[model samples]
Target: MSLPSPSPFPPPSPSAAFRPPRLLALAGPTAAGKTDASLALAREFDAEIVSVDSALVYRGMDIGTAKPTAQQLAAVPHHLVDIRDPAQPYSAAEFVADATIRVAQIQARGRLALLVGGTMLYFKALFDGLDEMPAADPDVRARLEREAADRGWPALHAELAAVDPRTAARLAPHDSQRIQRALEVYRSAGRPLSEFQQGRPGRGLRPAALLSLEPGNRGWLHERIARRFDAMLQAGFLDEVRALRARGDLHPGLPSMRCVGYRQAWEALDAGWTPAMLRERGIAATRQLAKRQLTWLRSMERRTVACDGPDPVGDLLQAAREVLR
Candidate 1:
């Protein structure tokens, strides 16, 4: 007893006193009100927000990306917003790494972490880890980029479809990043990119509470897309694009400039298209974006809280409570 006495440390706490790390993923199509709902949930749970949007990472991409206002940022701390320049390259792999670290840090500080955005690929990459693939080859990439420039991305997409129909079928023709990468992998690895992904389940970032916001009515969703694009125009979206163009460093081929509204805006400015025409094209692109997001949502294997009604915030809160309990 004397030998064991005078231990420097107190007795270990009961296991019941510990709470395992928990992450809330608020995912939805664009303009589906994820921003508002996520902010509400974050406030309720003392969580910090980590944006999952690809476009929101770029600086000077505010209006088109619908980045959080300064006021909103002040109320609830957000990570990974405006961390990259429009010309910089960021990928799902990088996002997974950075977000994983952020999640751990937030938990260490005795706070919850909420990943909020419309970028499904980012969500998928974080939750399900990426497969091993060939590294980027600048020479191969440059050649593909040149081919795209001369023959158009649709032509390159057709080439991909011929080689790897599985991946190509899921990717849009205008999805330059995926298209280029798939072709590069093919050129370097001598196999289809999809083949590498076949039958190999991702390691994933462990369990998370998933919530998806989708409009019950397709028509309603389309209307929301249209209205949101119109609001962007009213908010001087062209001026924002013009400011980026004024930088003289940004270009249409760059990932940042290719963001939905920004791409359409650039084409309109270059073609001298009328405002109404540009507006129509922007809205249509946004609708397509929503469609792609919904398709991904539909493919989820895990059970999620699907909030299709008007009260998304309420739905999210209720579902989160159940998951935490």
Candidate 2:
């Protein structure tokens, strides 16, 4: 797809004799038009794109992750996308480290760094920085995994809600890795995961302009979610999952597989789900993911521009350019 032309606005003029490192971060729910908005803004500012998406980091998972087309990637350089295999795991800490390096490199060259994607946790990590939480304990992880296997993740989620409701509220019931890690952190550290985050200073990563796109109407977002999933199905999303399954190294429990579409498709394929059921489940899971992303967006302390219109890319970029000014 051809990229939209760069915006009419000029790049932010340097304010002082000295210039601070400034990055642009675009965040929103699925199908909220973040990708296109970032592309337009990146072009306007001559910026390199750095993906903050979790699933997009994995290779061979393009359509399901809604990754940019090859044409678009070639149009604008993007960092931290498709950098990992499905068998490997990635985390917010890793994203912070990598994004810090990328941002610094872009600044050294005097180009803007535009961080874009729907992964809120990575954004939080980059902004406020992670607390020095206790390291993972194998015993705690194993125990929680055993409990999850025996009693289901929902039950464990409930237990976490009782203990660390703040963290539990942010995580979905099916988010096994986070749930397990949260529980492990609490068990090992003798403090709730949320408690550890209290009053931690940022890691001094470059300052960034934050823009969040939220649909004005829930119905509209739901419709978009359904339509996008159908498009993915037409694009052979199931076949992509099947290929991953046949790889013999990747598993459903892997973080990469637990991404919304891939997770549902993996389960559906095993249970002999009908095409209709697969489509329904895929759309529903996407809606849930969007809901979670929106919730995370709301909890952010940084003020954001509300994106509510037929053309959110236009609205978001207009607001983002003002931030640059």
lDDT of 1 by residue, 1-325 (tens): 0011121212234883366446777788898888889889898889999899999999989999988899998899999999999989788778888899998898888888998888887887777677767878989999999999999999999999999998888789988877998999999999998776543234565444567776667887787778888888999999999999999988887878888999999999999999999998899888888888888876764435555566767877877776565
Residue-pair clashes per candidate? 0, 0
Could you tell me which residue pairs clash in candidate 2? Answer: none
lDDT values for all models? 0.81, 0.82
Error of 2 at 300 (Å): 1.3
Q: Which residue segments of model 2 deviate by more than 4 Å?
A: 1-21, 137-139, 198-202, 206-208
- Residue-level lDDT of model 2, residues 90-145, one tens digit each, is 87778888999999898888898888889888887887788777876778888888
- How much is the lDDT of residue 36 in candidate 2? 84
For residue 71, model 1's alpha carbon misses the true position, in angstroms, by 0.8
TM-scores for all candidates: the values are 0.89, 0.90
lDDT of 1: 0.81
The regions of model 1 sitting more than 4 angstroms off are: 1-21, 195-202
Per-residue error (Å), model 2, residue 250: 1.1
